[model samples]
Target: MSSDDNAAHMKETKEGLHSDHHVDILHAEVLASSDLMNDAFDGENHEHSQGLWQSVKSHPWACLWAFIMCFTIVMESFDMFLNGNFVALPAFQRRYGVETADGKWEIETKWQSSLFQAGQCGAFVGVFLAGPVTNRLGYRWTTILALVMMNATIFISFFANSLTLLVIGQAFEGVPWGFFIANAPAYASEIVPLALRGACTATLQMSWSIGSIIVAAATYGYNKRDDEWSWRVPLALQWIFPTPLMILIFIAPESPWWLLRRGKKAQALRSIERLGSNSNAEGTQQTLAMMERTVEIEKKLGGEPSLLDLFKGVDRRRTIITCLMYASQNFAGNLIANQATYFFEQAGMTSEFAFQLNLINSCLQFVANALSWPLTAWFGRRTIYLWGTATNITLLMILGICASIPQTNSTNYAQACLGVIISFVFAGTLGPISYTIIAETSSVRLRALSTGVGRAAYYVAEIPMIYLASWMLNPTGGNIAGKCGYVWGGTAVVCFVSAYFFLPELKHRSYREADILFNRKVPARKFKSTVIDVRENE
Candidate 1:
């Protein structure tokens, strides 16, 4: 607040409690002892200007809680990883697929599409369910309920003798995964100081990469077996994540942001206290002031935090940008990249070699994700995402050109090399950074609903795209082979154009500052240079 505003707020506080002389005396004492404008009043402001490591060191407890919540993403990751990679397992194909004229067994492209899409569709429902449920029940209890729902649903897919049962089970299990996707990052973002927000939120993506890394190794180990256990072992592993996460969440602090939204100021304060409680009293109050002011402004601007508010007023731009930011992941070729193991096998590498290459790619993804924490801090979200997408275009163009020529060992190896590079760039840059962008873009009042709606858009885009990917990659389908890179390259161009126009640089901004920038309708290119009074709520 400006000097005038601060004086007015203090005046109003004193006048309201004027009849209570004791209150007035205590308020004066606080004013004399604590300066709201100084570093003591708000540690976040102090940390905001500090470097990344300083921020991390300041909020170690926040980081620990954030990690616990982010770890929930690992459950969703394992399910998704198994959903696609299982098709690449030779024994899995022998167990579930048909023998063709060439005497080779293969799972049909339609089934592959159906299995993954079932999970997508289920996640759509789960995200929608989570938004409202989370608002009422809070992030902690809602996660507990989702755990129960997920474990129960796993049984349906685990023992199924028919593909239909497995598909239904995958869809059912997806509902809980949707809940995890929508809330984990939001919870992480709320608990941390602003300096840690971007990297912490982006860690949701790292947990995902961690999940992929674990399952990749497991699938490679089991891929060589020609028995039912080859696939069943990985499916059984799904149970590992949720049970442990449920136990940890029982003792975790509720998101202060979520509590403040519910108008439980005391509880919000206590939750902040619980989350290592901000270092000092002045810092705690300052944190609450910033969080409270930001939430109140959003509520005023957006009104009552309904799902419809996501598309109204300034929120319209935010909601659309967030949703498309998510959809761009699929557009930039995630669905195609997701089937890399199958892509390699169809392109003529042995199944064992394909798994080996996939394992290497998964490991590289972890390294990229680890670097993204600092890179996100240094380069900013919009810059890195654009760089990642632009690089993918060049790589995909070359891959498409290579695919156009007659098949050769050299061309196959070239396509494999290009595919690994695309995933690596995505993991480090766009993939994880997108998590940061989504959290930053959504208005705090409408954050949970916005995340759900945006993630739901991701699931929706994947539906048709999954079918196209299956047809293009499957031998019995379109057989577009490595030339599929052209399709994703074309879409990456769309991602670049949309990002250039729509995505803004939200780096190093507090939630209040971000809201002010969007409210002013600043141009995307001008975001970094824009200045505001910030003292006035308007």
Candidate 2:
């Protein structure tokens, strides 16, 4: 055929194939050099026909991976908040007298009371150890070790008698909670489709809210029972939820990136194939390229991140911003959720009403979490954060105002209920959104470390507030609501300043793209000026 005729025929042929078939030529080109498509299709240039979700399910191994991941996250969330709804158990025991000395409250010396705080102390240790351990041991082993430690700790905690042993057990249990905190986000990010990564990343946080609801319901059911099993029942039930899931985690596929880092290319290909990929070839290619970039950047950065990197470098602002965000999250005062029963009692609500309030908060949290999924996507991260902060600030102020007014027999309780509703709304939105940002903000090399730092800050801020401030807020004949409001108002100021100055707008940015945006040598407030992306370059 003539050269002109052949060229015309080829153009028509390409257009015809494009119209007749769903596959993009560019996608095929991107997959050409990769191992993911090998043997799964027919010819040298054949396209993989399965839909994204279809591919996800068809790969038994990938489905198992996502399931195991989701399960671990769900259980961790459940475990993390076990103490949230049961402050009343110890408080009730203290109020009603549980083996106390003359004129001195001895509940502080009990295993049950100590268990409440020990888990958080353990989490602090876990957070400190996670980065080094994960880097050295690999994600799978880190996860496995954490699960083993957590399960063992849970079982041992049930058998403890003295407050000391309970604290030891709870602290030891923090090891795994730390492991989950450090690794789950990285693990989930590596496993799921980039398109769905945000949703899946938020999955654990959603499950956390759900788990809180579950624990609240259980606490409500067992609140008044005098049996030793009443507390044991709730504690022991942790095994029922996590043990089988631990076994599943053991068998789930190792992180594809982790495997790739070890030069296990064949295994990595098999891993992603089973795990889902974006249907567009460009996105998959982009992911693979980003993974390559992660390794390159890690090498160039030289050695693990130093403490100064979190404080003085281009990355320093990110660290500060994450810390501030985390602090705000904890400072919003979750004590109300955990110790709501006590807070209510101090505020003149009865024990029965306190439990009912706890149940209501848990339910509202679940609904609010469901609402956040759409809201976060519809409004950018920045907008949701601002909205949540404003909402929380307004709620806290109103609660403070209400508390200052004095609740006499003639006062309406509806305003008090309104304050409780506001607390629930604040948690549902900012609580999860802050977590989502922490996991996504930094580069892969620094993600776990940053997460560890942020969690440490979160717990440090959290425990003290819950234990001390909440304690003070409940002072006899004090403005309990106003005190709580003042604490949250301080948090709101931090949230507003941090959002405006330090935090970047990261919506729709890829991991590598985020790395570039954050690595730029500019103040965080000026990040938009230095932000770089391929689209902008083009």
Superposed on all Cα atoms, the candidates' RMSDs to the truth, in angstroms, are: 4.6, 7.8
Residue range 389-435, candidate 1, lDDT tens digits: 99988888888998999989998898888888888888888888898
**Cα-based RMSD of candidate 2:** 7.8
Where's the lowest-lDDT run of ten residues in candidate 2? 39-48
1-538, model 2: which lDDT tens digit per residue? 7768756754553344324343222222223323323321221111123333543453445445654665565555565556544445644355433553334232332333355567777787887788777767777778778777767788676886545665676777776777777677667766654334544555555666677777777777887776555566777777765567667776677776666555444455445544543334333333444454454455455455544456656566677777777777765545555555556655666667777776787778777766776665555576677777777777777766776675673333544575467657765677767766776776666666777787788778766555554445433223354457666767777777778766776655556566667665455555444545342211
Q: How close is candidate 2 to the true structure, as a TM-score?
A: 0.79
Model 1 TM-score on a 0 to 1 scale: 0.92
Local distance difference test, each candidate: 0.81, 0.60
lDDT of 2 at 191: 68
**What's model 2's lDDT at 38?**
31
